[model samples]
Target: MTISNHASVPETIALPPKEFSRTLYAYVVWGGLALALLWSWAPAEMDRVTYLFSDSGNMVEYASGFLTPNFHDWDYYVQEMILTVQIALWGTVLSIFFGIPFAILSSSNVAPIWIVQPVRRLMDACRAINELVFAVLFVVAVGLGPFAGVMALFVHNLGIIAKLFSEAVEAIDPYPVEGIRATGASKLQEIIYGIIPQVAPLWISFSLYRFETNVRSATVLGVVGAGGIGQILFESIRGFYYGETAAILIIVVITVTVVDLLSQQLRKLAI
Candidate 1:
């Protein structure tokens, strides 16, 4: 104690140097984002945002008409709504059938790079165009009907489902796959036994979610004469039958809500 135990004293430590590259990277990312927003502002017509407040009275008056919905044609609305659900169902089924193979092919872990790149690019092309555009084209090719709506939903959903499923495939635990390979199992057997089991739950969940989305999309496809409640909705709007339009919209909202709830439950069970 009298010696002060000078040899036991700890030395002060120095802090590590700050990473200039990380700081620079953060600044670059923020600067790019700022530039992008500024570039898009004028083109996006964001300056017209004030018009929403300025025209509030007109919107209020228009909305008031929807308050008193006419349910006189409820029977016909229900029938058309059922038809829309049917179209969505068929579209979702077809997409699931085709998406499985495409998903497998597009997965980097599952397929060669050559095959993955081309398949992914094709999927990108399919997804790039809106379902409405596909509906229009199919209507011209196959004539106006629910079939056009089904095809439109099929193509678009195929791209989405494949992308989602492939991601699930890629994220699977590699140990199971490696173990299967060690057993002298063929690649196909490894995928069938190891990969499919792991990804099946996610695939089912994805399909159910897409089915819910297809139901909503099918309603819009009727606007282009593809066939559904949307056709009736469009007619009501064009004829200025605001009350009927409101009723149709209410039915659509209720149906969508029910579908969403059911799909959510199914997804939970699947997971």
Candidate 2:
């Protein structure tokens, strides 16, 4: 045991080899994306890239008309803008009312597979169709008014709200729900006490966000005779009253900005 002036060397551990499957998967994903773009390029008119530069004068002349907005009918514009907001309010409220039950039914953690599958498929159908298409149909049924717009938004947003809320429900901490069940609480009671409390903040935030989106969508619904400022805006555009179009667009921008700000503040409070 005499001092052996030697230090023991640590073993060199080898790292596992990188998997070839991951690299192949990455290449497949990128190749698929490239193929999609290539396939659509001609149909999408990718060859017209030089047209913007060549036709710059026409764009300038068209855009110049919007530089001076005519607010002569400012009162009417404000009134229609308010009506648009009202449409969004009613639509969002109705969606929230109907979406709650659908959300619960669609949630995998809350409902049985038999119920969840059908409810989710229904929601998928609702979500797949655009609100504009729904607006067109409702206009036919309701005879062209804000009511049609309300129904359109309500139907489309119901699907969206349910999807958002179900996702929130699925992600909830299961401990509280388990505790409620342990206390001999019924299924509905467990959901009401445990699930609702956990997801309330997120649900409120989602609803507010949808309300903001609905406001913007409501503005366009008027084009389909669903009523609101979008009808007037479309008229101005069709009539080539560029000044009036500019004024209406300005009002829309301001209203959307204000709604966005208010919703953001409310979301902060909710969280």
Candidate 3:
């Protein structure tokens, strides 16, 4: 009786056998793709393992200079760091200002297909270009300083915020929008009275998060003559002032950490 029941259970619960050959074929294909990528782009003279072993001592010796960080120029560093923060602040504000309308236009539920496609494509173009590239272009057009950095961050972050905001808008509960329409509310009124309230917290949170990110990006923007601590850091590195570079890095790290923590707290509180 027990043997019959066990045999019947096998018939009831038949499972497909594992396909080891198929899995092996998949792994081979992936491995071949990886090899092709490496072959196409890797530096011609690069010997991955040999270089690390051969030049390790010199790398260690140079790195050792940064171990004892010198903060003798802390005052200048702090002043420039303030400028970086200010640039990021203005950039984030501009992104929010520009992103909101585009976000609405890009939302499938909110706008017609024609409006959505063009706005979304424009955002895609904005996001495809890196902040550094925008910074260089703006610097050439506007001629250096924090204005260029602000514009670069604004354009790049605009795309990111718009993409995020549209997703938030699309995910909103439909009932409120319907209720607003039932009252003969205009299209603009429906968006204002129904959609904005639902997504406002998330929009603010996203903006804060982007602001935190922009702070770090603004530092690098100065390297291209956008004007901030990055300029000093770049010069220090070029002049082999490892100590100053280390100090600047420390300040940036501390500032970023504090901002990140604060933003996280705000997100938790708001959400």
Clashing pairs in 3: none
Model 3 TM: 0.87
- Over the stretch 1-271, how does candidate 1's per-residue lDDT look in tens digits? 3667566744876789879999999999999999999999999999999988899999898899899999999999999999999999999999999999999999999999999999999999888889999999999999999999999999998899889999999999989999999999999999999999999999998899899999999998999988898899999999989899999999999999999999999888878
lDDT of 3 by residue, 58-161 (tens): 98989998998889999999999999999999999999999999999999999999999999999999999999999999999999899999999999989998
Quote the lDDT for 212 in model 3: 97
Candidate 2 global lDDT: 0.96
Each model's C-alpha lDDT? 0.94, 0.96, 0.93
| Model 2 RMSD vs true structure | 3.4
RMSD of every prediction: 3.5, 3.4, 3.4
Off by over 4 Å in 1: 1-18
Ranking by TM-score: 2, 1, 3
Residue-level lDDT tens digits of model 2 in 1-271: 6454497655796889889999899999999999999999999999999888899998899999999999999999999999999999999999999999999999999999999999999998888999999999999998889999999999999899999999999999999999999999999999999999999999999999999999999999999999999999999999999999999999999999999999999999878
Worst 10 residues of 1 by lDDT: 1-10
| Number of residue pairs clashing in candidate 3, backbone atoms closer than 3 angstroms, sequence gap of 3 or more or interchain | 0
Q: What does the lDDT read for residue 150 in candidate 3?
A: 94
